[model samples]
Target: MHTDPDFSSRGRRLLCGTLAASVLPASLAPAAASAAAGNWPQKPLRLIVGFPPGSSPDMLARAVAEPLGQALGQPVIVDNKVGAAGSIGVASVARATDGYTIGLTGNGPLTTAKALTPSTPYDVARDLRPISLVATSPFVLAGSMAMPAADLRGFLEFAKAQGDKLSYGSIGPGSGSHLAMELLKTHTGIRAVHVPFPGFPQVATALMGKQIDLSFMIPSIAVPQAKNGRLRLYGVSTAAAFPGSGDVPPIQSALDRQRFDVASWNAVFGPASLPAPVAERLSQEIARILQTSEVKQRLLEQGWLAAGSAPGVLAHKIAEDTAMWGGVIRLTGARAE
Candidate 1:
């Protein structure tokens, strides 16, 4: 899953000129001259989304693209390269020679995919530059109302009783839903089979068709179905109840103690070699856009919490989650087919 060990070495070399300028004397620095002449984003930029159109990542990508394009003064096109649990598109962005190419990634491909697919081509730490985190959506355990589970406790009991017969669907093999379910199974000692779909719609459809026992779905997709009596929500994956979903109880209340809280987050990322100035500019502009009342309202309507953090904070988050998921993956022994 890790890329060449020398990747960081080459990245360090590429950044050496910029790194030296800060320490060298003004009169003697060729680095400073080169940095001064470097104008980033002189052409159209491609924002690659690993998920298909209408997915959470795709929606957020479209939401931020206009403002990002305005700030960079270049077109920010969102290209959908959906496949391989998002590794297909992500690897494409990683291999692109153009600096303008970036990826709109989520928790799946950025962190969990590594553990799932050992031969994955891209390395998040070495290949991608972290930009601001756009938004976060918590997961919810949802089931068809025809089932006996009424809450998290009831769901666990029912799952235990069903044993190998019960099953759950997730976005893909290494998705947040799959990890959360794995953790739940480990904690509860339930033995539901893992069923993975290509995307959310298919999972939702399977639930509606009574083809699957349950699923961990995003609020935007699950909430509407729950309201229409198509799906019955058991509990949220978060430790506490979310803002809009008052009717749905938090999983913590049903279980004696909660062990997992997973959130599906979307963030903007570019090539690691992108200039610091350009990264800062993009971060600032995104922060401004998220701060606006209109944008905030739109995001709220979609069950997303606006998170406009600095580039450094975003990078730190990616690193922290990578380590966190590594432990979970090791514990569950989860892998892609």
Candidate 2:
């Protein structure tokens, strides 16, 4: 009976050892294969845009998607998840479980949205990882050519004179247009009612129709209208005149010793905890893509300057812009429509 019990104990121990050996190797097999292959982005990649179709960010994302798809040897899809000042798309990207998901972000959701809406679901710093900054452009302070404000100084004086009666249009609350206008209002102490539009085209149309008195717009979209006498270029929202539009002077130059600056930018971001190797690879490919002559010409033609910044550089920029816009929002008491 003692021999039988001892033999049974040995058999149980052997079975347990065999199970551990089988399970351990199986559990680590995927990790080992991943390490050996370095096969990041093994699946199709999704680039999420916070705006609807035909928007600036959406356009850029589409432009880059095909080339990036070729670079990664995987199909890249642009997913437009528009809403809540782009927070909806951004939050979707943040919550995505796949490593192949990235967000095409702009000033709205990335920097100014949180400041305008404190209840933002994802932390820009904690939930998203910066991939690269694609481009930058200065905002153009434009108005109806019919208005008396020919320049920035005259515009401010006109705004002050109009006082509570003055109204301006923005794409939406927490948009770059809104923040730029709010910053101008805060700096100049001019009070104007904010009229929110669904998108830039609507805002531009409203300006053309004289539905809105004044608004800040991007040079690519607004300058042509100004040239066609549909709208007048009052000033640019940069310290110096933008490179492409020599006729439009800087807002600071027109305002006596008062400084105002506002610009728009686009960047790529991936979900938090994206593998470092994957991020680095994507950054390198983006930098290369931006360096292409065709890409440069296209961006310049659109009134944008190619940024081509690395991942770390873009991370720093996001941090800096977030803090800067937070103060602007607080000071202006800006809010959503």
User: Model 1, range 180-231, lDDT digits (tens) per residue?
Assistant: 8887776678788988997788999999999998888888889999989899
lDDT of 1: 0.75
Residue 153 accuracy (lDDT) in model 2: 74
Taken over the whole model, the C-alpha lDDT of each candidate is 0.75, 0.75
Span of ten consecutive residues with least summed lDDT in model 1: 13-22
The digit string of per-residue lDDT tens for model 2 on 213-332 reads: 888888888988888889988888888778877678888786677767667899888766455556668889988888889887888888887777777777666655666667666766
Question: TM-score: which candidate is best?
Answer: 2
TM-score of each: 0.80, 0.82
What range of 10 consecutive residues in model 2 has the weakest lDDT sum? 15-24
The Cα error of candidate 2 at residue 320, in Å, is 1.9
